[model samples]
Target: MKNTYFLKAVFTLILCGFFSMTYAGTIYLSATGNDSNNGLSMGTAVKSFSVAQGLAADGDTIMVSGLIDFVNDPGNTATTTTSGPSTTNKVGIVITKNLNIQGTSSDTDGFQGVDTQTFINTRFIQLTADFTLGLKNLKLINGALITDLTTVAAGGGAILMTNGAIVAENVVFDSNTTSGHSAISGGAIYIGGSNGSGKATSFKNCVFNANEGTKGGPIYIQSVGNGGKITFEGCAITNNLANGTTGGSAFYIRFNAPTGKPEINIINCTIRGNKVTANNANGGAINWSAKTPNTAYVNIVNSTITENTTGGSSTAGAGIYFAFGTNATGNYGNLTVSNCIVEGNKTDAGVASDMQVKADAATGTAPENTVGYIAVKNSMIGAVTSLAANVPTANITDATYYNYITTLTPDLKAMLVRNNPDDLKVRYYTLGDGSPAITFGKSTFLSPITTDQLGKTRPSTTDISAGSVEKNPVLGLRKNLDSAILVYRNANNQITVENSTNDYTGSITVYNTLGQVVAKTAATGARTTIEKSLNAGVYIVRLNTTAGSAAKKVIIN
Candidate 1:
């Protein structure tokens, strides 16, 4: 009886110990911390990241100091080569368990309440095992090329995720490169999976700049098996270079799975100024290739792909390239682009300066069985040199509008202007008046997106504009202003105000550009005719309602 009781007590104690280890306490890291400390609190923080890595377990949180050199290991040296890992290198932060590594800032200017200075100047993070990893509020820069020698998975100057889920938010990856030529890819990040396995990765509010690789200068995601999903939201990938024969200067995605197709969702991203500098390079901004019988899906919503170029006889897709394998049986890949602006992209070989979609074979069993398919809706393309049969004409304004009409140039410039070509952050192309892009979008899209790229609500659910910024009503009026009242001038130089909603009790006022009140009328309901015999010129008409007020520019002929 005593033996049984003792055994039960021992088992219970083991379970308790397991739970305690699994729920390990948080570890604090600082530049001035001592490596011999316990690292459980801010006072007893650890100095070296390597020591923290050894002490941390699954579900542990590593709170790094906001100091610039918190994780910038001086002992870690980066290699200049492209194909292999560093020689005199620190093994990096090899994460085998689920962890939350965060950079804490004391700066009041930061958005997250704390001004955490999370910058890593050297070394990279590698996720070798399958688990959930969260990295937030950090900047990774000047990381050397690191690769898995066995799998030939090179690149990832900042991070390499072989098989795991990663959520990276508010991070910046800059000035990282893989210089040599042995299948070097993913200058900033490399996500790889094989044998019917894949990973789910998401990047939110991240910036990748000046990273170089043979393919995917900023990011490379490849899946040899089934089910690889990647989402990049509000990311800026710019000024990256791809020097290999096959392109994707900013991003490369390969869905090589034979059974299930992988998916890539890019929302509100700006991919610009990336270049491909080799022969036969494709997709100066993005290169998507499907090598299996299954179909890979890529959805781009409310984004901008512009100013990317390809050189040295690269024949297609300066902004984007979609290709399918020859041996694929079913539909290989699919691309859905909505509410986007694709402009200023050029290719040296002169195929399509903006985008190119190709198949290994022209003939297929059915329409859905083609090598690849592209669907573009509510978009502005700089040029459409090919794939006219696949591209729809609904709510699509081509470069010809800008090329033919001189008066429309100002409006186009106002709507699609890149304020600064050099910097990616200040890039904004909002809608201006008299632009065909305004109120020309389709009522619905394949994706459930209700907001524009800038997080503004669409004025009309039925008729939204194209590109990232939706056109708001004049003078910050309510969206139902148009529905409430209608104003127009008749043949007798008299202004007619028609209120569709009987509940609208307001006053009508007209003024000229010089702030002089030309006419005024008090509404009594329904139709209110005001005889304002004024000279023929431009005037501003305003309606004041109990709910709100609306203004419109009218020309009296």
Candidate 2:
């Protein structure tokens, strides 16, 4: 029994993604160094990342400094043109082992910080083995995908992951692109486009801001086998452009395997302001489709998707759009939304806005159940287009569980630094004053996805603010004067209340700005006086009248 219990415990830890990870010796690379010296120490560092990687073993660290320009590395240059990707594809240096490509920096806010990032420019990285890589505190900018191959398999403008997983933190993918005629998919990163299956890759506190591609503006993920997974926690997917005439401006996900379940998990992230400029496209922020015999699963929690646009697409799902199967059988794709704020997105002039789940009967055999389904719970939705009967919505429209912004008092439209080009690295949307997103999330949540996107502790373990920035829940209530009921403070600092109408008979309550009740009394049509000493401040006085519940500001001097 003890041995069995130990095995079960180990299995639980494994399922929870806990494992021992250790790195070997570090190989130092500097801009002003020579390859003839041993690269084990910083004093004797090598000049190139390629030479450092060649000297390091598996599970080692390649500490880089300054600009590690791949254009100068003779092993791989930006001008090489090759094809097939049978471990011989060129245009960049290919990493063949598992190594932590550590950049000497602590800042990854995209622009300026204390740790000057070791910028990687000019070439993309290809993985030929199933190795796990750890990337930390760096910026990959101005990388280009070679135009040797003309198929979608030749994807990934910045990186092409044929196999293995990469856990990246505090990284930024900026200004990566593909030659439009190349017909590639991913602009920032591509995973499992060829016969090689994708592994579980995760990015935490990362930014995918400026990338353009034909299919996916910033990223494209596919599963050729059962074990592919993509997880984005505390990430920002913003301002990307999907130039593809097809769709998927920010993220495009495709499941094309015959078996295996592919999954995408997005938590505490923000998908905003992306655009798809295609004549006919689907999602402005995200697009997903699964082929026959495969079921794709997606779970979105405590995130925000808003302000995304799709041009010329008459009826595009501006925020999120997806379909599954081709009239074949099986629930090819499923999505679950929990405690998320998805609203205020714009499509075309005549189309819908926020979210849409369309039906695709492209190509399939005798029907089995090739339909897609969505489960929306505790989410604020502005409009949903083409919602089918298969979608199960729970508390989507209920104000008690989910709140929408209809008035200016609690407006979500007022954002901070959203259009400021100078501060684009640290830009995030604010939930305006009196927002319902304040303190709206539960404190207890899953472990890894609890933090906010800006690499800070969420005010609630839980963004407390819902979207990105954590705001204090000092919501100012919209006060409406109730003529029949009057409440004020006496000269002696005692609270006095009266019901002018006989019909009004209920309890009266006073609360502070933090949604905490400070005082309460029972009303019975008689002049009531509460002897509780109150301080000088604004308080919301609520009355439970027979007509309905009402609240107004009762100034206490």
Candidate 3:
């Protein structure tokens, strides 16, 4: 009898443990007319998005029903109402735990009361605490807001993230705004790390449209109290707008360095139609303040930043702005552009500051003390047309500014030009044929199939300029081109070639900017090595492969 009782107790304990491990919290809310306290039944759901949020714990799930708006008056019968999404309702639902907030699939299951009009008045979500908020299969709209500056202060708008780790998946942040009052600005989403974690928040498979802020229209990541980490993966930020001086309409990463600093990583994302008006600083879609962090600063990898416009011809950095800082000297951070596309970012009348010159490049120039530092690998950076001839204005209205950047003045383009001018040193394989962002960046991994804002691959071959060199030259001009080419030349005018191709079976031809072939060489597979000297200039490489023909560009040191 004693043994049987002991066995029964053991069985009961095992069963309880199994149940606890499998159990997950569930909370149901309704934006529709129904209000039920029976949290278990769909028809009997809670009323407010906040109530459901307050009740959720770690590993819990919040389910919302009906169409509701935090800004607009729920009593309004018409969709177009004057008093829409207002501060009276903060965020629809804010989660601080590693929980999931999902919506029903039917039209009646989600919040449908949100619209552009309402988004102008309130914020949809503000995530600050440390936790992963997984939002899936839900349509979240009209979030974050910009109060009318004509009557109120320019500050106080959008979703502000002071410190925390967030995961926003398959979420939509649309029509959000923070109208600028001169310098005060707002945005759809604002993330900062004042706690110095350096890992702030991340957005995955998210969509941002028509969000507006004076600084960063769609999204802004700046150092707060402490530095944190911010990352964007497989996301889209388009149709974002800044008033005039702010950059990174789609997204911007700035290091404040108040105490600790933050790092930024943007991967597999698309940024397009983001605008920075004239009279603004670093109108390029993305601006790097280069403020020294207690630790490392900003890093962007495997992303696409294209088709962004600065308002006026006098503006600078339609693609990127690397602002100089004095408070933090050697603390200059690093900007690594790898396996990405950066095309169609243009500036006004004068050439936009492509890259800030550093020590070696800024020897005798003003601001002799270089502050900005950037590294480019296996990437391409050029104007849509040859910048060697005509300079475009900084405004988006100009046709020239509409083109991408090419023929950058290295002395003016960047602080550091890594790898080769014509080759992107980051990728293992080269891009091929008619791609706009050919060699725009170097990548540590293989390229993706998806195109950028301009619908071009991250690293396309056939660049107007020698952009990048990839690992595999299967289709492009590597077959007929020399695997090794000269990069830099010495004062003696001696040029050397370094063959770095996996397979070198193509002919080599050199050319000047005039499209005239200056030198030519023929080679067979029998001997895979060749040495030659040539003048410093741009050249083309055409290869005839057993499969077909292709072309690439080469630069003589």
Candidate 4:
């Protein structure tokens, strides 16, 4: 009897442990809900995000309904005076475990996507654990006024990740400020650590606007030993301000290791309209500094960096500032600009505007003082003056280079004009007819880039264009082919092709908007009819012959 009782107790304890390990549940929060509720369902949802944070464990999901006011949370207020390296006091929505926090449509399972207008306004949020935290379908607008800080240790006005990873999708960080501090930085988001534990933080389809930081207006990333990796994909960073003694109006990255280099990749992004107010500011859009022997790799691909300005008399690199400290080696920490548009970036009078690369004087027994390399290939760069000679190698093949001036040819000047001045998110200029940028890109570079900055496909046969906008196949054809080939849609919704001189016989193929060949027909005489019925939409008609191939656009009624 005694042995059976002891066995029953052991079995109960084992079952409890198993349930604790396996029971990953979803927690819900709502504005009308009470903290006394269980938070297990929509009806039992809690009221405060902090209350949900206290109950959530790793691998759990927190669905927040309505706007969460972090400022008025009783639990957050009670702990506002706490102090520590990973302190959650005063910081809003402190995430200590791997969890997914998303906004919901209702209190139930129906989840609404992120609302860009509504946001959680708070001091800041910190992720201290070495796990992946996901924030989706929500905006984080931090209005915290930080002061009396003397180091970069305490930063991140909007979101801070000390050693964790963050996957933020469709989020907006707007108007966050880190001011009145002696050494404040990272106005919007800060990722600081050397542990190299967390996965790379990725921001996809996010917007960062009007954030102000002493150093990095939108973001500041620092790696002391082993650096961190951050990627910005399809993100728009605009209208941010950097008022630090030194400046990175959009972001700042520092790598302080001797060997392992941190990496920052910007792909399909628009970084424009940011400003650096301090005199002698660097990188109105980005400032990257490599300390000691450490290295950092920055790749800007299929993006636009334009209209960023610095305020000082001797400011340099209003677009980007890449600095290499003593003891750095090779292209390990180089900046590569591929298939990008960098234009209209300006500095104060007598200052370098487009970009600057600097290397500290050599020390110890190093063979050479190699700061870093800046390679701009298959890109359109305007008004670039580098401080370090032989550092920037501009591969000008099929690339356009022009200073901001009104005296340019009418066609070229039209390509530099902004498409929409009212929208800060619109980064690319429209390529006009007879513009040099049309179909002038090299095929080698275009092979890797499937689509242009505006999500437009490059012309299939012809060369790609410089800058973010890829010319349409019809536009390229209009410039390449003679005006004798008349292409139009007939009354029967058929494509009619007529060569006036009857000098050519070729095959015709029709392509849809997705670059897929939809129809094919043979052209025997001067005039040929495509018998295939077509939908009422735009299509590209390609004519292939012994002479060459040309494409034209036709719309069916």
Query: Using lDDT as the measure, which candidate wins?
Result: 4
Span of ten consecutive residues with least summed lDDT in model 3: 389-398
- The best candidate by TM-score is 2
Give candidate 3's whole-model lDDT. Answer: 0.50
Q: How are the candidates ranked when ordered by TM-score, highest leading? A: 2, 1, 4, 3
Q: Over the stretch 1-557, how does candidate 4's per-residue lDDT look in tens digits?
A: 99999999999999999998998778998767899998999899998777887878878989877766665666543113214332322455566678888874212322221223543234546676677888777766655535553543656777766777888877777777776563567888877765456367888777788889888898887663355677887678889999975788987876555456567788767788898898756566888775545546777776668778888543367887776644343222556677676766776552436666665532222222233645666665665555434342242333334333222421222254566868665645666543444554554654654676566776665466655566654444533344667789988899988876577777988887667788898876789999988999888787776666567778776
- Cα lDDT of model 2 by residue, 1-557, tens digit: 99999999999987666433342678887767688989988899887667888999888888877655565665664334443342222356788788888776634311111112543234457764778878888777767664645444657777877667788987888878765353577888877632344557889888888788887888887654464677888888887888776567788877665556667888878888788887677666888766545556777777788777888453477787766545542326766666567776776563446676666532222222233555665455555665433343331323342323333323442233343445345335656444545545544433444456665666543325445555544442222224566667888887777767766678877787666888888877657776688888877666776665555556676
lDDT of 1 by residue, 1-557 (tens): 99999999999999999989766678887767888999999899887765776788778888877543423453334444345545433335577677877885323111111112543233467776777788787766666564444445555767777767888887778777664454658888877764224657788878788888888888887663366778887777888998887788988887666566577888777787888988666566888876556777888876778778898443367887777646443236777777677766777644336666665543233343344656666666665444544443432333322222122231222245555555655445555443445544554752465666556666644566656666643322223365677778888888888888778788888877665678898876888888767789877676778966666567788
Model 4 clashing-pair count: 1
User: For model 3, what is the alpha-carbon lDDT of residue 531?
Assistant: 46
**Candidate 3 residue spans exceeding 4 A from truth:** 1-18, 41-43, 64-68, 72-98, 103-120, 147-158, 180-186, 195-200, 224-227, 258-261, 293-295, 327-332, 348-371, 383-557
RMSD (CA, angstroms), candidate 4: 7.5
> Which residue runs of candidate 1 sit more than 4 Å off their true CA positions?
1-24, 67-91, 105-123, 146-151, 194-199, 312-314, 325-331, 348-352, 360-371, 387-414, 419-428, 446-449, 458-460, 473-557
Model 3 quality (TM-score): 0.63
- Model 2 deviation from native, Cα RMSD in Å: 9.4
Instruction: Report model 4's TM-score to 2 decimal places.
Output: 0.71
